[model samples]
Target chain A: EDKVVQSPLSLVVHEGDTVTLNCSYEVTNFRSLLWYKQEKKAPTFLFMLTSSGIEKKSGRLSSILDKKELFSILNITATQTGDSAVYLCAVEGTIGNQFYFGTGTSLTVIP
Target chain B: EAGVAQSPRYKIIEKRQSVAFWCNPISGHATLYWYQQILGQGPKLLIQFQNNGVVDDSQLPKDRFSAERLKGVDSTLKIQPAKLEDSAVYLCASSLVGEGITFGQGTRLTVV
Candidate 1:
């Protein structure tokens, strides 16, 4: 079964702190890894990583994938309360547009 | 540049009751997806449609769950005799070829 596992299921940190979330996957015919931030209802797109070593960044958020190791990491620098949300990791497979998603990491940035 | 649209932001029904949800994908988007998101969990793909054809519905519980995308623009998902365990957020999303998906505010379902 294709599976995506995310570590640190939940985290709490003070404002201005930095945090890192982890995601590991096991699947056949891996295509790409994606990150999303879900606040209340919908999950907004974050980053999509297809190549190893090349990191994708946006403002204070960044992510990287390691295909060989079958893992990925998302980093948030200078986190604020607004950054508190569930971070999800998903992997798209080569088999007919299928995607496996991890349970997600719930982040709470306390002010 | 409107995003994916979904209706019935919230629904409450007794177990064994039936309910339906609607979704309107972004204009020209070829792929539409319906996902179920339980509390504290990431979204799970329930079905996928390519244009007006069913591309994937392997995970969908066809016994009581059915969905259709007519005219390749809008879609609807129906759940018959909903169970308490079925309570969750149903998310609708759409994506163009080789593009990231755009999600709509999900419909929160509560089966009492």
Candidate 2:
């Protein structure tokens, strides 16, 4: 079985629409869930979710983690063309700093 | 602070040739990482270094691949007799205290 799974391998939306990306994981010694946005080259860190329930937000992007189900949700409101990129979900283990990453969701926001 | 730096932004070499990628992590960062990402795939960790010592290199193909972090500042990943399967983007990332990671632009390798 895979350690991390991301739904909707690709997505398309209007500039003003809202989009949600999902990630689920099953790893031993789960520690934290992280989200990153990749455009042309390297993936840049977006949010880090260590605790559940509380949402982490930056601009139009927000993410929340659910330890019970071992899942995470990334929500983008009022999306723009600049927001078009691949969103990656990563799960870090507690015992070791090993991180398992999802395949990523390709998001395209049309202007 | 300057972000992680990688050399030879892109390389296209024939199979069986040797190629090397270099990385310079952010200053004061204690941990460094090397990752391989095939086309349309997520980055996969190949090695990890803590300061001047190696923390993990289980995913590295020791038979044909080698890496070294000299002075705990700069790192070099070399592949000898590279195979077609070795074509991928090699990324170097660094972190302090594991809060988050800063990644390099990556060195894209194309084994023709």
Candidate 3:
């Protein structure tokens, strides 16, 4: 079974603070790693990391994958109350179309 | 152009009752996925389809749950004799093979 583990299951930060979320996975066949931000309903796509070392960024959120280490990190800077949500990391297995997700890290940004 | 769509934003049922949810993937998306997400947790894949063919469904509870994507577009998930443990948000997503999947708003089911 493919397992995805995330550190700091929950976090709280004041506005303008920066936080990093970690995700490590052990899968038989690895293909892609994805990050999502979920509020109340559906999760919104944030980034998809396919290569190692190269960081992908959008506004204040950025992420990087280390394939050799079998891990990834999502960084958020200048966090706002709107940034308070569950950050999820998922990895697609090498053989099937299935993707296994981590339990997620709940982030709370205080004003 | 449009995102994946799911129906009955919320549902409330009693134990042992049966319920069903629907999904419509984005146009031209050849791959579709169904996921179950409990509160405070990430989505878990229930099934996947590619062009009307089953790609994966190892996590689905076959005895009480069944799903289908007909004509490679719209899909439905049905649950019989619901249990409290089955209460969760059912999410529908679609992708284009190499691309990442796009999710629907999801249907939250509450079992009493």
Candidate 4:
């Protein structure tokens, strides 16, 4: 079955800490991997990575995909209280343009 | 460009009651999707529509759930005899071919 799994279901870190979240998947006809930040009810898109080894970055957040390894990592540097939210990992396939999402990593950044 | 729009930001109902949620996809987006997200979990795709046709509804619980996009523009999802497990955040998203999807604010449903 096609599935995505994320590690460290929950995490707590102090401000300025650097944290790495992991996502691994097993799916057919992989098209891309995406990361989302969910605060309260809405999930906002963070990054989309389709190429392996190439890192996609914005401000203090960055992510990279490895098609061969079937896994990806999202790094958040100099974290702040505002960074506290559930980080979701999703993998899209070419079959139906549908996304399979992991349970997400709940992150709490302390002041 | 305007983002996807959803209605009734919040809804609370007793179990066995029925409810309907609405969605308006981004203008010009050919693909639309409905997802159910439980607290602390990621969103799960319930259905996907291309234009006004159903591309996928395998995960949708059709027994009591139904959806339609008649004009290929806006869509609605209805749930009859709601269950406690059905309490979730209903998210609507839309995207053009080869582009990432854009999500709406989502509707939070609570069942007693």
Give the per-residue lDDT of model 2 (tens digit) for B4-91: 9999999999999999999999998888999998877788889999898988898899999999998989999999989999999999
Best by DockQ: 3
Model 1 lDDT tens row, B23-93: 99999988899999999888989999989999889889999899999899999999998999999999999
TM-score of chain A, model number 1 = 0.99
lDDT of 3 by residue, A3-101 (tens): 999988999899999999999999877889999999998989999999999999999999999999999999998899999999999887666566788
B32-100 per-residue lDDT for model 3 (tens digits):
899999997878889999879998888899999999887788999999989999999999998875577
Scored against the native two-chain complex, candidate 4 gets a DockQ of: 0.75
Q: Scoring each candidate complex against the real one, what DockQ results? A: 0.72, 0.65, 0.76, 0.75
RMSD of each: 1.3, 1.6, 1.3, 1.0
* CAPRI class of candidate 4: medium
Candidate 3 DockQ, CA atoms: 0.76
TM-score, model 4 to reference: 0.97
The alpha-carbon RMSD over the true interface for every model, in angstroms, is 1.4, 1.5, 1.2, 1.2
Give one digit per residue, the lDDT tens place, for model 4 in A1-111.
999999889999999999999999999989889999999887899999899999999999999999999999999999999999999998888876778899999999999
The full ranking of all candidates by DockQ, starting with the best, is 3, 4, 1, 2
Q: Candidate 2, which segments miss by more than 4 Å at Cα?
A: none
| Model 2 lDDT per residue over A17-103, tens place | 999999999988877888999998799999999898999999999999999988999999999999999998988776545677888
Which scores greater on lDDT, model 2 or model 3? 3
